[model samples]
Structures are given as structure tokens and as C-alpha cells.
Target: MHKNAFAIHGDIVWSKNPKELQTVEGGYLIVVDGISKGVYPQIPAEYQGITVVDRTGMLVIPGMSDIHVHAPQYGFRGLGMDLELLDWLNTHTFPEESKYANPEYAWRAYQIFSDDLLHSATTRAVVFGTMHVDATMTLMGKLETTGLKTMVGKVNMDRNSPDYLCEKDAATALEDTKKWLDEVEDSHFENTKPILTPRFTPTCSDELMEGLGKLRAERDLPLQSHLSENLSEIDWVKGLCPWSTCYGQTYEHFGQLAGDQPVIMAHCNWCPDNEVEILKENNVFVAHCPQSNAQLSSGIAPIRHYMDLGMNVGIGTDVAGGATLSMFRAMADAVAVSKLRWRLVDQNLAALSTEEAFYLATVGGGKVFGKVGSFDEGYEVDALVLDDSQIKTPLELTLAERLERYVYLAEEGGRIVEKYVAGRRVL
Candidate 1:
């Protein structure tokens, strides 16, 4: 056992429930052996021997998880922002994604991705890598050193993609994925793992989808893909898999959807009844990329409805599509989109609140991967210590209110003073 026990003393803030928030003004977290043991108002006499770090007035919150992001496209964020989904994919996305064939390009691109993510207050992420296996492998290596809990995906696309970007065939794609997995088997990614990433229905043939699904079951790895993101994309899915019920069913028909394996589908901005039921039935997690949806002109997702149905969901930065890696901004955008969605879609489901958004960014989707996401007792000690020493907020503001305000408007400099993963400070 390690003798280096640790504790964080600060003004702690975190969720108490899905709908409620909590704060302890003079709270401290006891991180025993890299896992949280308990939170307290003062150090207990029995545990006085452990080392403690004092933050005085800084806010300590659970580290965030980004459920969907593209590692290769991190550099292209905010460019080509005016185009909608299909046009955007052909113009900016495919062109940029094709450059990964050169391992040198991968290093340059992924270095920006890894470094930005390292400092962005996101301690856990589900990331998409470009289709080139070698380039994707390079990304996995860089991510391992960042100390974030990540699922790095090697993207698959066999049809209707650019000549330079698409895979040669199903067999080659699967083999490439296998090779990447094999190489990483000994790399000790720590908390990072490889996932199956099919680039949506139109890009994958039936054969490739089925092969990946089987591999998922055999290895128990998670699946990440786009779902109902845009009108044209959904139409393309219907045309390709006409026998299926809806966009989600295309994956379901080929044994690709879910059984015991984990599936995270991004941008469910337009899922229908059967699709939502399929998600609920199989326990699939929805990765809500609000800024991406807004930027790509994909309609607002019915997030309030999903929460009403008790579906698990989380916020994602979505990088080039969404624009920023700051989970703080993503949380604010999530609430903004949900309020817009509530006005247009359905008013019955509660509009998104700050508590719900922050909770989703932390513990909600982290539950999909296990033992990650929160400072809850027995949870991993992945957390962020904010340096708000210079902020001039009115002293009357509650810590939770101050946190909510920070999420809406704080720049990267003020909020993330130091980042921690499993009780060890990384930055």
C-alpha cells in the first residue's frame, strides 16, 4: 500500500442529487489511497497524520467528463463555423481528417488536442481519432501521459467518404483496430481505453458494422458513433438501413446497438419514440454536444425530455464541431440549449438548470465507464481546484451560485488552478 495519503481543504462544491446542489464553505475531502473516503467540515482527529493542501477560499469541484470529442479536429475549431452538417463534413472536417495519414501530422495535431484537453478542466473524455490507424495510435500514446481518463477511438468509415479518408474495406478496418488494440495492450494507458468508432450509418457498410459489433461483445469495449445529429444525416441513415425502424435501429438490426456492451451516441437532436425507447431499453448514454449542434445548425436536442425519461446523459465539448474544450462553457451551453429546446419542443419537461448541467458534466455519464466522475465517497479523486483568488464577486454569493456564475462566464485562466486525477495533481 502507498503511504502517500492526501486531502484537499477548500470550499467544496458538488451535486447532492440529480436535481439538487450542495456546498460546504469550509469543507475538506479525505482522499485515502487515491479514492475519496469522506468529506468533512474539519479534519477528524483520527486522520490528523495525513498531509493536507489548503486552498483557503478556492472552490473544489468534481472533475468533468466530456462524453464526445474529436482529437484530430481540435485544431480546426471555430473555422468553417457557418456551414451546416453535410457541407461542413465535406468541406472542413473530411479535408482536415485526411491529413492524419502522415504520423508527423498526427503528432502535431494530437499535441494540440492533448495539451488543450490537459488544461481545460476536463479530467475524463471519450474522444474520436481520425481513421488512420498509425495516427490514431499516436494520439492514444499522447493521451496516456495527460492523466485524463479517456476512451480513444479509431474512426471507421468504408463508404461515401473522401478517397483519402475512407478505409479500404471492412476487413482492413477491423484489422487496423485490432492492431491498435494489440499495441496498446502493453502500453498501460492507465485510465485510457480504445473504443469502436463507426463514423455513423452512411459511412459504414453492413459488413463492417456487424464485424465491429462482434468485436465489441468479445472485448467488452464501448461503442461511439453519431446519431440523429442532422436532418440530412438521419435521412441518409434511413436510406441506407431501410429495414430498420429508426436511426437508432440501424445499429440495433445488426446486433450493433446494445446488449451488455456500452454505447455512447452523440447528438440525439432528433430521435423519435422508438429510438428513445431503444436507448432506454439498452441503457445507452447520450452525449449532448450542445455547442456543436448549434454551430453545425443541427436542431436543439430534446434534453429535458430525456431527463424526464430517466435517461443518462452528459455534456461534451465536441472540439472542432462544438468549438471549445472547456467543460465549463459546455455546461452553460447545455442549459442554454435546453431552455431553447423547452420553449420550442415541449414545455412539460423541466427546463435544464445549472445543477443538472454540472451534474451531467461530472457524475452522470462518468457512470457509464465505472468508478469515475465524482468526489462522492468511494469515488476517484479526480477534481479541479479553481484559483478564484482575484475574482471580485459579492461576498454574499453562495459557493454554488459562484460556481454557476463561473461556468457561464469564466475564462480558462481563473477556474482551473490545478487538475487532479485519482488524488494526484497533474497540473
Candidate 2:
């Protein structure tokens, strides 16, 4: 009766080794319904009764993940590209975030982010919502419908932000986050879940961080926030916590780092040696937003070095700060920025190749949810079906090469024809 079995016939790429890419050609990935059983060169005789979905001639890879992103900033992407990190956040981002006070206004904004997510090659993500509880709830409800596996947060920021955007006190901020959790506790999305979001150390008080930390232990949920993304931000973090050794250490001291929490911190552009050790030691996932860093004039992150050091790193759109939703663009930008960084400052062959960059955008980030990011055996089948029909009619290329072209050559909307999250059709 084959209760749970399907045959996925395609060129399957997945990881048996975490670092080295494994590609199986002319293969049929025999999935036990949702979970992959094994990939064979041909459909085996015993599993012939299973439903066979022919993805032959299509490049089947794991659905990409955006581990760090700000959903509220979708409306303002590419607007303030000329500004640096702090200025961009203050002049454009903070004001846009404050607009979410109206849940109606929030839905109008979040719909754009949601629609874009399904449209792109990414199928799983960790998203950030603004502090407005009702608005954040509306955003969550909307994102849940997309069928993407996501962790969303109601952001907490008590001080150093504008009066319109900032909270009056830590207690109120903590209460608001709890209220958010309570409301969404019964929300029915297979993938959408809530996590604690303190905007950053500069805006969060000691009390707020501690309370959230306590809640983290209680719920055993994943955590997401900004880390040493910029020089000014790192210095601001230092000013906030004089006792701490580095930016990441402050979070560690607050018990936010190095646990089973599945913590995701965006941007490691300026992570010092001590900070790197802390992040690596505690098993922190770095949401490497290369384009946002360059657009905001934040220094290029040492991505190759981080990979060499065996740090858990992945790509993020970061939306308005990043100036794009397309992780494909992020992939290209990561490569471009690394080259610039290597030429201008650090010298060496430290640039990220297209292969490496796309790998991070997909598999590296997917590990946060589980064994996602690839289409081998016994893995969740989150996938983005790319259509290069209009873009590449004449070019004869390899599957991986076509994938690279899909990232650089095609515009945002056309390439990702359909999206699948955990073997369920989303597009």
C-alpha cells in the first residue's frame, strides 16, 4: 500500500559531507513520502508502486534559507543605499518600522515580504517583525500562510531609538514580547513559530535581555539578533556593556549564546578574535548579510576566514538594509564584496566563489531547521523550481553553471517558478 513513498527523478545535489558538495546524476531520489529514503541511479524494483514526480532535466537542490532578515523593512528596500549602517537605520529604517503601529499598515507591508519570499528561491527563513504586537501578529499570520518554515520575532527595543519606535521601559518591552508569544501560541502554521527578539544591545536594557533569556530557557526556542555587523555598532555595544570583552560576549554573559537555543546573529563584518571564539564556542549561527554590509558602507565580513575557522554562517537578505529580497542577489553580492575586501584591505585568495556563496545561502542556513538545503536521502524536500526559459534560451551549460546564471542573469521574479517546503507544494 506504500503509505509514504514517492520517486523524485532528477539530478540531485546534497551533502553527505557538510563541506563538500555531493551531486548524483541521472538519479531517482526515493522519498518515503516526506523524508528521503535513498537516491538511486534508477527507480528500484521494490519501490515501483510509489508516485513518481519527474523532475528530470531540472536541477534539484535544497531550498535556500535566510537566517536573518527584517520583514517590516520590505517597503523601503533600495531607498537609502547611499547611507551607512547607523544613518540608514535612523533616517530610513526606524521611521519605516514605526509605521507598523497600525496592523492594517503592517499587513500591507508584510504581504510584500511574504509574496517575495515564495517568489524567490528561498523556502525557509528567520524573520524579524517590528515591536507593535498586533501588527507583528498580523505579520505572523500572513507569513504562516506562505507554507515556508519560519521563525518570527516581535522585536524589543527599550532605549536609544526614536520616541515613536522605542519602548518606554524594559518591563513593558518584555511584557509585549510575552503577550506576542501568548497570542501566537495557538496559531496554526506547521512552520511559523515565535522567538524572542531584542533589537540589539544598544537599544535593549540589562533587565530586558535577562527576562528574555529566562523566557528562552522556559520555551527552548531559537533566538535571533544583530551582532558585530558594523564598527560603530560594535563600539556602541562596548559603551553599553563596559564589563564585556567583545560584542558577542555580552550576549553570552546574558546566557543568550552557546546553548541549544539555535541562536542566529546577523553580520560578522567586525568580529574580533575574542568575539569569533565566543560565537564559535557557543555554536552561534552568523547571518552573513554581505550586500547590506556593502550598501550601508559596513566593512566586508571575512567570510572565507569564518568558513575556514568553521563558524556556522549563512546568508540573509536583511531587506531594506540589504536593498533586496532575492537571495540570488545576496549570493552575487557576497562574491563581489569579498573580492573588493581582498583587494582593498586583506590580501589573499579569500573571495567566495559562486559555488560557495550559493551553498551558504541554501544548505548552511537550512541546517538551522534541520537537514534541509539539499535533496539527497532522508532530508526535508524544501525546493525552489527555477525557470530560465526567457533568460537563457541559447546557452548550453552544466546544471550548477545554470544555477549560477540563474542567480546573476535572471531578474528577481521569473527564475523561481515554484517553491516547495518540506515536500508540500507552496507555489
Candidate 3:
């Protein structure tokens, strides 16, 4: 065995596909230099001398991924749940995000959010920061210290935003974004990097979007933003850009949906067929924020349809809008909302199963980062050691049943005993 090789023995469970989950009862998962070596029934002879951490009774699963979350909104999570999408943003989101301009407030708030994220089941995330460059950098620095891999974006909004939060103009927005990216490039971050965020079509003028697209091409950075999330928002976009055929087309026309770049668009709840084709053509990833959609009265996304059409999909908390940071909550919400959609919205579609929901929370979402959220060989070893002993059950339960129970019932506390990012124990 290599000197750095180590193993953890537990009840291992992970998704093999949306329909199948691979389970190993009392198996040994080997790790060598932060890469998964594979799972074995027992420690192999070649690895016999290596260190083995015996987590006999715990359930070991791949770490969850949150593809869409707003780090600035973490401070106000669980509030303003009664409002609709546009109203909620005007009332809650923009106001709270505006506060990030204050360096001290940003540091304190981001530190708290980062600490919670480090302790939570999420090992990887794509997070949104506010328009303030220093504050966004502060959030990045705090998250970097937690040993989690993340992509943080400094938001760009030059129009249709509160005066306090909006940038002066497109040139100023691009200049600030360039400065932020240059700083990130020079810092040599190991697990964290920069993403380009144009708040959305409504807030981002065509000029600003065009400039951001150029910046993305120059830096070869990923992009993230909202999509057709609500009816009112869609109408507003149409009013703002009358010449565009659809909201997705507005992005494509501006080069924001460049074919060579990776983009994650949140709340694709109301995407039309043509827009769906555009998403598919560009191979764009959808961040399905189920709980946030429900909370904000946004319609349920056709996740089943997306799957049937072979579109890339992932789950996200979308905090404040989602009311919780738990990807387990996101999974349960995905399954529950899909049931509603299947029964009432579209009888032709099938409801999401526990296995599928689990897949979205792990493997499906992990694809955005590549080769994560699974125990396959040559994959990074981001995992969680979960102890569900607190849940009382009269009969002995299978590992799958236990996982389902944890997904639906685990509350806000320390159910996660340990968290690992790339084979390094971070918690």
C-alpha cells in the first residue's frame, strides 16, 4: 500500500444512475492521495498494512452538491416565504444583498454562512455573491478556508435594479468584474475559482451581458444566472427586450450562452420548447431549485421531461428562497414536488423516486464539477459520514431505507459526523 493510502469501513451507498443505487453493507472504501481507489468487501492484501478508519455503524455516502445557492442570502434564509418571485426579490433578496457593500457586514455574514456550509453535508457548491467585489472576495476567502470546492460569482447588474445595488453602467460593471477576476487569477486558489454572474436578463442590460460574455471568453470562466423562473418575470423580460423571441434567445443573442462555455441557469421552471432546444443545443446545465420554486410560487420544472430529453439537471437549495441549506431537503422537495406535478400538472410524466432524488442531490449535481459525488475509481473522494442512530425504528432497516429516512426526516443539527472533500477530512 502507498504511504498515503487509507480506508474507511462502513455501510456504503451511492448512485449508479437515476434508477439504480449501489450499496455495500460493511464495505471498505479505499482512498489514495485524495482519489477514490474503489470499494472492497474487505481490505485487499496489498492495502492490508494501510491505516483503516473503522466507522462500523455509520452510513458513508458521497457528499451532496448544491449547484445553485446564494451565499449572500444565507443570512435571511427562511424569511419572506409568502411572496412570489419578483415581489420576493424586490422585497427580500435585493435589500439583503445590498448590505454586502459594507465590508464588515460582508465578512461577518459570510463567515457565519461559510461555517454552516462547512458543517453541512454539502462538499461542493456553486455560490452567488452580491455585486460588491470586496464582499464577494471576502465570501470566497471564507469559503476557501473551509476546504470545500466552490465557484463564487461576483454579480453584475447594470439596469433594472435598486439604485443602491446597481452598477453605474456596463463599462463600470465589466471593469469591476475584470478586477475581481484578475485578483482571483493571481491568488492561485486551490479549491475555489471565479464565475461570471449576470443577475438575469431583466437586471442585466444587453450592453452589460455582451461585455460579460466577452469577459467569460477571455478568462474561459463558467457562467451562472436565472432563467424563466416566473410568469411575471417572463413578461417583464419580454417588455424589456421586445425583439427577442424568448428569454433564452436573449442570452444566446448576447453570446452569454456561448457553445464553448459551461452555464448553469437556475429556476428553469417555465422554459418553453424553443428555449429547451436552445438549452440542449448549448449543453447548458439546469439548477432545479424545487423548494425555492415552491416557496416563491414559481411553477415546478419539468425535471422528468428534462431527463427524458437527456438534458443535464442538478438540485440546489437556493437559500433564503429555499429556506434551508440541506441538500436532503432539496432531494425530498424534488420527490414531493414531482409527485404533485405528475398527479395534477402532467399525468404523462412520472414522479421522481427516492433513488432519482438522491441521484440529483449527488451525482446529477456533481456533474457540473466533473467526476464528483460518486465512489468510482479516479473520482475525488468527497463523502459524508452520517449517523442516523437518533431516528428510532422498531424493525431493522436496510441501508436504502435508512438513507430515505435521513433524507426526509433529518433536521438541522449534527447528523453528519464527518465531512470529507477530496479524501481530506474537513470536519
- Tens-digit lDDT track for model 1 on 221-318? 88899999999989888888878889998887767766675789999999999999999988889999999999999999888788879898888888
What are the clash counts of all predictions, listed in order? 0, 3, 0
Which number leads on lDDT? 3
Clashing pairs in 1: none
For model 2, where is the 10-residue window of minimal lDDT?
12-21
lDDT of 3 at 76: 89
lDDT of 3: 0.91
Top TM-score model: 3
RMSD per candidate (Å) reads 1.5, 1.9, 1.1
For residues 70-154, what per-residue lDDT tens digits would candidate 3 score against the true structure? 9999998989999998889999899999999899999999999999999888999999999999999898999999999999999
Tell me which of candidates 2 and 3 scores higher on TM-score.
3
Higher-scoring candidate on TM-score, 1 or 3:
3
Q: Arrange candidates, best lDDT first.
A: 3, 1, 2
Misplaced by over 4 Å in model 1 are: none
Model 2, span 1-427: residue lDDT tens: 4777777677666554444556666678776657767778878888887888776666666788988888988898879898988998899999999999987788788888888887777798899999999988887888888888899999989989999999989899888888888898867556799878888899898988888888888878789899888888988988889999998887888787745868998888888898898888888888999888888888888888888888888999888788777788898998998899889889975788888887898878987988887776668888665556666457677666666777787683345555678887798
- Root mean square deviation (Cα) for candidate 1: 1.5
